[model samples]
Target: MNLSRPLLLASNSPRRKELLASLGLTFEVRVKEVSEDFPDTLKREEVAEFLASHKADAYKEDLQEEALITADTIVCLDDKILNKPASAEEAYAMLRALSGQTHEVITGVCVLMKEGKTVFHDSTTVYFKELTDAEINYYIQHYKPFDKAGAYGIQEWIGMIGIEKIEGTYFNVVGLPVQKLYENLVQLKIVV
Candidate 1:
């Protein structure tokens, strides 16, 4: 947790906070409202990075000695991006679409300091077993994953039983790519 500068995490997600803390990094949590909207022309794979960097841009002038970290996660099913669900029906629909299908979970992170900035991303391919209506309903009622992208948490009950395999880092699906982020922190000399 020896950081060269004060570390600031700009996200309200508990998962992101937990993941970052798991790295044994001492940091402060800070969040600012930023628009999640992206241009339609942006490639689906790039949306996460775009949003992450957009969030970091907000504090370009505000940041000084502290290294600001911002992250954005998205669940992509082919050409579609499954964002956080707004309602139970939406959550059910997203989970149903994910049933027995392979999707990509992309998490983009931006680290900004007064010296410079670094933006990167990590992608994980997740395979889900065919989920039943009952299972989906049960999870929705119990977990209420409305705050999570793709209507599910890979660390939750649904993910425990539903995820069959993953081709990349498991933490990416949980909302942060700690391995990659850790490497970036070291490279940036934030972690000494």
Candidate 2:
């Protein structure tokens, strides 16, 4: 849990917090309200990183000596972004769209310090088996994945049953790409 500097995770996501803690570095949870909007001109692959950096900037003025970590996760299918669902019907539709389809889960991360900043992203391609309407409803009713991107949590029951395979790290699909983030923190001498 020793770190070169105080670490601040600028996210309210429980999954990200858990992932960061799994790295064995103690960090403080610091949440700030920031706009998640991105330009329409940005490609699907670029939005996650863009929003991550944007969130990082919002916390820059508050940075003293602490290293701030910010991240944004998005689910993309056929060049469309599936944001957090607002209603059960929307969640159902998203899960339906993802049934038997391959989709990209991209997480953009930013490590910011008063000295400098590093912005990067990790992409994982997730393959879902065809899900039955009953299965989808069951998951929605039981898990209530409205807070997750793509209306699904890879660590949840639906993921256990629906996910067939993934090309990249499973942790990336969970939320934070801890391997990459740990490396970045080490390279920056933020963590021992």
Candidate 3:
């Protein structure tokens, strides 16, 4: 483990903060504003990684002696990407569309060290039970999922009752995939 370099996490997501904290790694948050908009030509699976790399690029100059971690998570249904909902109606629509469907939650992570950079992605298949309009409305109004991709949080009230099953790392759906991040760090000799 390298103690001389500090680890900087560049994201505004509290879920990402909490998920990274769970790994017992010490880090500092350095939020950067990058335009999340990407080319429409990108397949649904590429968007997350592309945006994550974009975020990492923003911190490239600042990490000469630090490890910079940047991440992006997106929800994909039928190959279409669902990002954060902008309005209540949009949130309801996203939730309604996800009702009774299995969607892919893809999280892209980038770890930039002094001499190298690693970018990877993880996908989780989440199955949602059939939800009623009342349920969708309730979650949109109560949970206020405007900040979450797919308009819902798997760790919140909606996921507690609506998610029936999952096929990959549950923490990926939360935000940063901590296990993969830790393994990558170890592989790169950035952490023990």
Q: TM-score of the candidate numbered 1?
A: 0.98
lDDT of 1 by residue, 1-192 (tens): 799999999999999988888899889998889999999898866899899999999989988799999999999999899999999999999999999999999999999998888988999999999999999999999999999999999999999999999999999889888989999999989999
Please say which candidate is ahead in TM-score: 1 or 3. 1
Tens-place lDDT digits, model 2, residues 1-192: 569999999998999999898888888998989998999999876899999999999989999999999999999998899999999999999999999999999999999999999999999999999999999999999999988989999999999999999999999899899999989998998877
Overall lDDT per candidate, in order of appearance: 0.93, 0.94, 0.89
Clashes of each: 0, 0, 0
Using Cα atoms with residue i matched to residue i, what is each candidate's TM-score against the true structure? 0.98, 0.98, 0.96
Which tens-of-lDDT digit does each residue in 79-110 have in candidate 3?
Answer: 78898999999999899899999999999999
For model 1 the local lDDT of residue 11 reads: 97
User: Candidate 2: lDDT over CA atoms?
Assistant: 0.94
Q: Which candidate, 2 or 3, would have the higher TM-score against the true structure?
A: 2
Candidate 3: regions farther than 4 A off: 1-4
